[model samples]
Target chain A: MMAEQISIFIENKEGRLAEVTAILRDAQVNIRALSLADTTDFGVLRLIVNDNDKATAALKKEGFTVGKTQVLAVEVTDEPGGLNKVLDPLCEQDVNVEYMYAFANPQCKNAIMIFRFDDIDKAKEILAQKDIKVIDGKELSGL
Target chain B: MPIFDIDFETMPREGLEAIQLRRLQTTLERIYATVPFYKETYDKAGIKPTDIKSLDDLRRLPFTTKQDLRDNYPYAMFAVPMEQIVRIHASSGTTGKPTVVGYTKRDIATWAELMARSMSAAGATNGDIIHNAWGYGLFTGGLGAHYGAERLGASVIPVSGGNTKRQITIMQDFKPTILCGTPSYILHLAEVADEMGVDFKDLYFKSGIFGAEPWTEEMRQELEAKCNLKAVDIYGLSEVIGPGVSIECVEEQKGLHVFEDHFIVEVVDPDTLEPLPYGEPGELVFTSITKEAFPVIRYRTKDITSLNPTPCTCGRTHVRMNKPTGRTDDMLIIRGVNVFPSQIESVLMETREVAPHYQLEVDRIDNLDTLTVKVEIDETSFSDDIKGLQAMEAKLSHDIKEHLGVSARVALVEPKTIERSQGKAVRVIDNRKL
Candidate 1:
C-alpha cells in the first residue's frame, strides 16, 4: 500500500509543530500518524494526513518548507511474526528503511504500517512480485 | 629607511603621495616582468610602466578583480618566485573557490607593522594583553591581530575562535584589554558570559576589533553594551594585506582610517567603473604599495562605502572611510530592481517590533518571482488574533517595498523561529534556478 507522507523542514523551536497542525486544521485536514527526527538546528516533521494535497498547499502558502514523499504501507497482524514477515522480504531484497512507524486500522483488524525505504520503486516491485496487496491513498484515508 | 619599511601611518600627504608613486612605478615594472596575468592585462590596456608618473595616472592601469585571481589560479598572479613566499591566507569561500593571497618576508613585516599601528591607534599598547579570538590557520583575522599584538610588545593570548568556556577562563586569567573577532561571535560570547554569571565589567578588556562580516551600528551598540567594552571596526581582505589595512582610532569610532601611505584607496561606480567624487557611495578599490609576493594594483574590493577627507579626532592624518553598508556583489536583482538585506534590516530596525532574525527566500512560480521574508516577532508584539498578525505582515510587506524598492511577501513567526548563526547568518536563500 502507498502511504502519502508529508515531510517538512522545521526550525527547532516551541510551537512550530503546533503551527503546522493549526495550518492543517484550518484547511480541514486530519493527521492520521506522525513522527519527528531532530537535529541541532532543525527537524524533519513527517506526517500522514488525510488530505495530503490540501495540507501541502496550505503549508506552502504560509511559507513553510514542506516536501511530499511516497512511502510504503503494509497490512500485517498484531502478533510477533507480523513485523518480521513484512521486514524479511525487504531485508532479503537489500532494501534499507530510513525510518518506520505503525498504526492499527480501526476499520479492520490488520495493522497499517508506514516505512521510508532507500529505493521505494524497488521495494514496491518486490512487494508486487510477492503478491502483497497494496492499497491507494483513498483506501488508507478512510482508516 | 627602505621606502617599504618607512612608517606610512605618520607620513605627511606630499611625502606619502611621492612614496606611493615611486612604489607604484617599481610594482608595475616588477609585475610586467614576472606575472603573466598583469603583463597581458597591462598590454591590453596599452599602458606603459612609465605612464604611472602621478597618483591620477594610476587609473589608466587595468582594474584587478577577484575573478582575475581565480582565473589565474594557484600562484599564477604571484609576482615573486615561490622561494620568497613566506605565508598564504585565503578568503572564506562560501560562494565558490576561495581567493588566495600570499605574503613575502617584507610583506609579512609590513602587515605586522600595519596591524600594530591599527591596534595602537585603537589605544592598545605594550602594557595591555590581547585575546585574539579570530580563527587561526587559513583565516587571516586571528594571526593578523596576533602578529600586531606581538609587535606592539603586548602579552598576546592567541585564544583563536570557539570554545567559549575556555575563552572566558583565559580572559579571566590573562586579563586581556583587547579582543578581536567577528561581531556575531562577540555577541554570542557576551550571551555565554551572562549565562555563566561572569562579570564582563570586571574583565580588563577595554576594546574589541570586529570584522570578517558586515555589521550595523545597532549590532555594534548591542555588542558594546553586552560586553561592557568599546567595539571598533577593522577592515581588510586577504586580497590586499589582511585585517590591518584600516582601523578605528580611540578618539572617535565614526569611520575607519585607511593607511593611505602604504595602501591607496579609491571609490568608483561598481558597474561603470567611473571614479566617484568623495562622499559618494561606491565600490572601494585598493592598490598595495608595499606588498612584495602579491602586489595588486587597483584591486576592486566590491565593498560599498563613502570617503571622508576630514582628519579624524584621533589625530591620524590618514583619510577615513565610512563603514561599508553592504557588498555590491551580494546585491540581489529582483526582476530589474536591486535590493540588499541591510536595507531590509534598516526597515526592520525602524519598526521596533521585529527581531533581527530573518531570512529572505526568493522563488519563481508561473514566470513570476516572489520575495518572501520570514521575520521573527518580538515578545512585546506577539498577538493571538489572526487579523492582527495579518495586519502586521501586510505592514511589513509595505514597509519593505517602500524602503527597499521591492515588493516582498512578509510572514511574522514566533520569537526565534529562524535559526541563529554564530558566524555569518545566511540572509538570502534564492531558489530561482536558471
Candidate 2:
C-alpha cells in the first residue's frame, strides 16, 4: 500500500511539472494521480504511479530530488460530507494530516482521497480501529 | 599554513639585503626600458636607476596609491609591451572604477612558481591531485592556484567555483589530495557535502590554501574542523601577483609569509604614510620587484597588519605578516568609532547559534547611524516559539554590543534568508547614502 505513493521534491520553477512528467513518460512509468504543494523557490510533487520505484529512480537520475512516503487512500462516497467522514476519526485521534488531494473513479462512483500525515503508522492504526475503508496499493493504483 | 619562500625564508639581514638590491636594479632597468608610467614617474622623482644602489636608497622612491592606478586605467600601468602581455586580473568593481592589473607570460610563470611554493609549503607535491574552486577569469585567485598546482606537476582539476553539488561530485570522483579556494567557499562545500551524505573525511582532500578575503583565527579553526584538513591562508593582490604573494606554512596560522624576494612589504600608518614600528598594526604597502608588466612601486595596499621579522619555526627566512586585521578602505566609521565586518564575523562565529549567513544593515536612525544584524538561524534549530526567538535576538544584540563596543539590532531569521554567495559573501549592507 505504501509503495504506490511517492513524495518528490520539485524546485518551483517554470515547466517543472511538465519536465517531471516527461521524465516519467520516457521511463515508461504511468502516473495514476498527482498533486503539488508549492512555495516560491521549491515545491513538493506528490505522485501515485504504477511503478513507484521506476518513476522515483528515473526522476532522481534526471537530477530531481525524490523521497518515498506512505499515504492512506481512503474511500469516500460521492455525496456531501464524504471527506468529513474519512477525516473525523483521524482528527479525533490527533493524527494531523499535513495535506490531501482527491481523484474520482468514473466507473465506481467513489472518490479516493490521498492523505499524508506526520505519522503514517498511527494514522493506519486509527483507520483500522474505526473500520474505515483504507484501499490497498492495487486499488489505489487502478483508480 | 602560510610559509615564507624557501630560498629567502631563513636568510640573515645581510643576505636578504643583497638579494633585494640585485632584484631592485633589475626591476628598475626593466621598468625604465618598457614601462612609460615608471619612466615618467622616475624622471619626476629625479631618481635614476643607479641611485637605487641598496635597500636604504629604495625607500627614497615615491609611494603609489590606488588612485594612481585608477587614474592610469587599462594598460597605462603596464611596464612591459602589450605583445608580451598574457592576461589581466582586477579587483571587485564595487567602490568605483575597478583597479586593473596586467600580467605577462613571464609574470604568469613567476605566479605559478610562487603558487607552487605555496602548495609545496603545505605538503602538496607531484603525487597529489589538486582541485581548485576559486572563480576563474579576471579574478586572479582561481587561476593563480590552478597554475601553481600545474607547475608542481600535480594533476590539476580546474573546478572554477559554484554549483556545490557538482563541486562535491568532482571532489568524490577526482579524489583530489589538495583543495584550493576561499575559506568561506570550502565551508559552504562542507555544508553541501553534509546534505549529500558524503563523508568528506573519507575522501582524499589532505590540505587547502584559503584566502582572498579577511577571515579570523576562529574561522580557521572552524573550517579546519569541518573540512578535516590543514587550512592555510594565502595573501596577495592583483597589483602584486595574485594569491601566492605569501602563504601560511603548516607550523602555525600565525602570519602570512611575505614573498620579499619578488615583493617588498612595509606597514605604514594609513593617515601619515609613515612606517609603523614592527608589531604595531598599520596599513600594508608593497613594491613589486620581479613583476615585468606591472611593477608597482611602494603601492599602498590598504590592508592592515604588523610585520614579524623574527624567524618562524618553519625554517624559512622570509618575513611574516600577521593576518590583516581590516582594510582601511572597508573600515566603517560609526559615531566616531571604527568597525570592520570581520570583527562582526568573529562575533557571529563566536555566538554559535547563527549560521554563517548574515548581513549588516546600516542606516541612519534620526541623526545616528544604526546597525541591524540579521542572522539566519540554522534550520535544525527552528522552533514555533515567537517569544523565545525574540529573546534569542535580544541576547545576540546584547552580547555583540558587550563584545564589540557597538550596539546593534539583532534579528533571527529563518534558514536560507540570507543570500548564499558563490565567492565572497556580502556581509555589510550600508544604506547611509554616503
Q: What are the C-alpha RMSDs, in order, of all predicted structures? A: 12.4, 18.4
Candidate 2 lDDT, A46-111, residue by residue in tens: 888888778878976775556666778887889998878878988888888877888876558998
Question: What residue pairs are clashing in model 1?
Answer: none
By lDDT, the best candidate is 1
**What's the lDDT for residue A13 in model 1?**
83
The regions of model 1 sitting more than 4 angstroms off are: A1-143, B1-7, B93-95, B331-434
Off by over 4 Å in 2: A1-143, B1-8, B93-96, B331-434
Q: CA shift at A17, candidate 2, in angstroms?
A: 39
Chain A TM-scores, all candidates? 0.91, 0.89
> What does the lDDT read for residue A22 in candidate 1?
96
